[model samples]
Target: ESLNKLMKNLYSTHPHFVRCIIPNEFKQPGEVDAHLVLHQLQCNGVLEGIRICRKGFPNRLVHSEFKQ
Candidate 1:
């Protein structure tokens, strides 16, 4: 099922590439589904399953009170 796995991977990374099916009308979790994309090569084929990856936070912030 390479095609199925491939399709699954594409929808996981780049979510914007795919359109949402349920339109978020009910705003329910997992109620609807859509295609997602995976830009990073590291994430390839991981869409069929779960894999742990490094996490990072946004270092830049806007309109911060601490800003002078």
Candidate 2:
């Protein structure tokens, strides 16, 4: 069946996740609700992950090094 093929393909690949957070209910540009954004990041563990990465690698990479 199609579902079986889909599951087989998914299991064979490395999946990456992208999380999109809404800044505000009004959907206005150049206007972000700090509290809402903070709540979303905290709930999603994004802040904690960033903190861990910073602690592990405190060195700042140059643009060329980063590009490589």
Query: In TM-score terms, which candidate is top?
Result: 2
Writing each residue's lDDT as its tens digit, candidate 1 over 1-68 gives 99999979975863323332343456677653333224322245443333333233212335663353
Model 2's number of clashes is 0
Using lDDT as the measure, which candidate wins?
2
Query: How high is each candidate's TM-score?
Result: 0.21, 0.55
Model 1: per-residue Cα lDDT at residue 10:
74
- Per-residue alpha-carbon lDDT of model 2 for 1-68, expressed as tens digits? 99999979977975545789998879899899999999999999988878988888443567996666
lDDT of each: 0.44, 0.83
TM for candidate 2 is 0.55
Q: Which pairs clash in model 1?
A: 10-36, 10-37, 11-36, 11-37, 12-36, 13-37, 14-37
How many collisions between residues are there in candidate 1? 7
